[model samples]
Target: MHIHFIAIGGAVMHNLAISLAEQGHQVSGSDDQIVEPSKARLKKANLLPEQVGWFPEKITEDIDAVILGMHADINNPELVEAQRLGIRIYSFPEFIHEFCVNKTRVVIAGTYGKTTIMSMVMHVLKTLDRAFDYVIGAQLEGFDSLVKLTATSKIILIEGDEYYASPVDHRSKFHLFDPNISLISGVEWNDSRTNISKEDYVNLFETFIETIVPKGTLIYNKESTILREIVEQTFDCKINRHGYKMPEYSINKGVTYLHDGDYRIPLQVFGKFNLSNIAGAYTLCEWLGVKRDDFYKAIASFKSSIRYLEFVASVNGSVVYQDFLFSPYKLRTSIHAVKEQFPCQGLVTIMELNPYDVINENFLPQYASSMDESDHAVVLVNKESIKDKNIVLDDLEQDIKRVFKHKDFVFLTDLDALEGYLESFKSLGFNLLFMVSPKHNTMNIVSFADKFFKNF
Candidate 1:
């Protein structure tokens, strides 16, 4: 098969193009701009375009399929050329669906915990030597690429994102999978560039429920009240619905252990929220016929990576932690977890107010009181981040103040100032937690944080 990709420089797109090349397909692609990792990986596979930017001349009649990427718009030159030739075009999700048309599709869906839960299921299945295909949103510890495909595997696990599948396809990516086995880790009202309302957001999942293959299994988070209610209201006897809550556990010396009767299994992950994700993953594993004992052993080796409570450094008794927390609930859970995990250390938290919702002044109030668990908290807001959204610092501060209402809470705009403030904390002997998203395009957080830890 001959496949051509548009905007092939994307992290996942490059991997998919490489996968196709390695699968013995003749692959070629073009992108307006290509960066490190993606650029290097594409070149290594000899799939890199000799020149950047789309060329209508490359879209000849012989190409089998053209894969469109999120980076390409509806009027993209390559996309337009492919359509002119009447070639089959596949959005990222569409390609996956076509590849696994006969396989049992297992999609992990939610506004939260989807990636981690999907990672858990993939890790355990791989440990059990199960042959399966997978598509995840993030780079994990053991996975070679965010996507995998095979001719013989009967199962394909995907992180079902609710975002737009492509510039031309407004349908939610999860809506494209039509999974035989599905898990909705949790659901929360969220805003998107489309300005989708709360009702519209919830309705997407309701639609997702109806798309499950007949007699399919849905394992959901019982602890999330909104998600639980959504599942109950839909009550379908045709599809099996199982509710999973947090697993019973105890923490010892800052390490979390999931208790399985007489055995206390230590884990590389911490917190009650992660335990809840494990429960959701466990239920999925059970549905797949993995033995209970093997599940435990596999989960024991699972270590979460950066932005999921990844320990950065320990300067004296004070440690630094980082996470990719985007939602209010996730931020609160992480803040509380850090405090609980290191009760003896003075907890200080640093967070970036730069997500789409955070930059929108109207939604800023949703985070009120969320970070009160931290003894001293800093909220970093980039003026440039909110500029495009028309959000001002004063209004954002007021919204944050309304929610946090903390005596020691402080807000800063300059990245250098924020780093200086953190550096001043070195002598305070407190555990510093970075409850931030990696979306801060201008700053390299790891390198910046390294300076503080080394100075201490």
Candidate 2:
């Protein structure tokens, strides 16, 4: 098979290209911009385009399929050419569904912890030598790529995203998977452009549940009242429902241990949220016929996904962490996790208003008390980003101030100013918690912190 990826520089697109290439399919791809990791990985696979920009001439009928990325606009020349030539074009999710159609699809969906939970499932399965393929959002520690597809694998684990599949396909990416087994980590309204109203935002998941095959399972976090209500109202009887509560546990000397009756297993990862993720992973593995004893042993070796709560450095008595938190629910959960882990420390939480949903004036109020758990909060928003997105900064700031109700909290528009503020407080011995989505400014927080803390 021959596959050509349009806008292949995307995180998922590049991985899919490599997966196909590794599967002995002739693969070629073109993108306007190819950044690090993706660029280097494509180069290593000898799949990177000789030239960066798309070429209509490259989209010949000889190509078996053209995988379109969400990054590619509807007006993309190669996409247009592919359509003109009557070539089949599949969105990334659509292509993945085609590959896993025969396999038992295990789709993990949520507003938060999807990547971590997916990674956990993959890790446990891999350790057990289970023949499975998977598509995860982030790069895992031992995984060669973000995606893997093979003829022999009987199961395919997918980190289900709620974002629009493509410019032409407005349906949520998760909807395409049509899962035989699914898990909803939690739900919070996200993707501003796709889901406008609260009801509309939630209806997607309801529809997702409805799509499950008969005798399939839908495992969900029992803590989310809204999600549970949706399941009760919409899920069909054939779809077996399972609910999970946060496992009983305690952290001793910075190490987290899950206590299930008399059994005690120490975990490499910290936080109540991660503990819950592990519980959900264990339950899913058990449902897949993994023995409880084997599940615990395999999970004991598990490390967390990158950037979920990655440690930066510990200077003096204060430590700093970089967390991938964007949604209001994630913000609240992450803050609570950090504070609970270090109760004696003064928590200084800094988050970048980077997501389109969080930056939009209409959505700012949704995050009103998201950071209330933190002792000191700093909200950072890039002014240029707000202007480019046509969002009002005053509206965001006003709502944040009203919701946080913390006089010590400060809102800043400049990264340099935020860095300066951190530098000045170097001697304050405060534990720093930085949360942001993948944005131009948020991506640099680690570099800034490294430089600032090294000198301090």
Candidate 3:
């Protein structure tokens, strides 16, 4: 098969191109710009386009398929040429579904925790020598790529995103998976960039529930009132439903252990929210025929990357962590978990306020008291991003201070100033917590932490 990728510079897009290329498909790709990791990976696979920009000449009718990336605009030259030539164009999700049509698709969907839950399931399955395909949002440790496809794998675990599938496909990405087994870790109204209303956001999950195949299994977070209500209202007698909450666990000396009756399974991860994700992952794996004892043994070594409140480094006994937290409920849950994990340490949290949060009038109010658990809360604001979004930063600092209601709240627009502020905390012995999304163009928290604590 021959595949040409439009806007293949994306993290996931490039990986998919490489995976297909490795599978002996003729793969070629183009992008306006390509950065490290993706660029290097593509070059390594000999799939990197000689030139950076799209070329209509490359989109010949002979090409088997054109995988359109979210980064590509609807009028992208290659996409336009493909349309004119009547060549099939598919979004990543659409292509994934078509490629794995015969396999049992297991989708993990929610506003948050889905990535971690999906990672957990993949890790456990891989540990037990199970064969499966998967597509995840973020890169995970021990995984070669974010996307994988196989000819013989009987199951495909997908990290179902509620966001649009592609620039041309406005439908929710999860809507395309049509999973045989699905899990909704939790649902919350979020992503000001999406402009999806609270009601619409809830409706997205409801629609996702409807996408499950007949007699499929749905594992959901019973603790979430909104998700529970949706499950009840969307009840399908043919669909088997299994609800889960935070399972029995004990934290000793900042380490979390999952309790399976008399046996204690120690984990490399921690936090109440993570515990709940574990329960969700455990339920899904058990349903997939993994024995309870084997599941516990394999999951004992599971360590999520910093994308989910994982530790990065320790500086003079002060720990530094990066997490995927943005929504109000997630903000509160993550902040409380970190505080609870290290009750003795002074917590200094730095959260990035993206352009969406800066521009949306309702976004800031949702974060009220969300950072109350932190000893010092700092908001990282990119002045350039605000300017690019055509938003005035008038009174944003004051607005955040007033909304958080924290006595020690601050917002920094300059990276140097933010770094200096963090340096000041060295003497204060405060543990650093970065609650920001990696998708946003900002300083690499992991790289910065490693460099900052190089001596330590």
Which order, best to worst by TM-score?
Answer: 1, 3, 2
For TM-score, candidate 2 versus 3, the one ahead is 3
Between candidates 1 and 3, the lDDT winner:
3
What lDDT is obtained when candidate 1 is compared to the true structure? 0.83
lDDT (10s digit) by residue, model 3, range 78-163: 89899999999999999999999999999999877888898889989999999999998888889989999989899999999888
- Candidate scoring better on lDDT of 1 and 2: 1
lDDT of 3 at 61: 71
Name the lDDT value of residue 35 in candidate 3: 95
All candidates: TM-score: 0.91, 0.87, 0.90
Question: How high is the lDDT of residue 24 in model 1?
Answer: 97
Q: lDDT of candidate 3 vs native?
A: 0.85
Q: How many backbone clashes does candidate 2 have?
A: 0
Weakest 10 consecutive residues of candidate 1 by summed lDDT: 436-445
lDDT score at residue 246, model 3, on the 0-100 scale: 92
Question: Model 2 — TM-score against the truth?
Answer: 0.87
Off by over 4 Å in 1: 191-194, 355-359, 383-403, 426-429, 441-443, 448-456
lDDT of 1 by residue, 338-404 (tens): 8888788778788887657675656677778888888888888777666767666797777777777
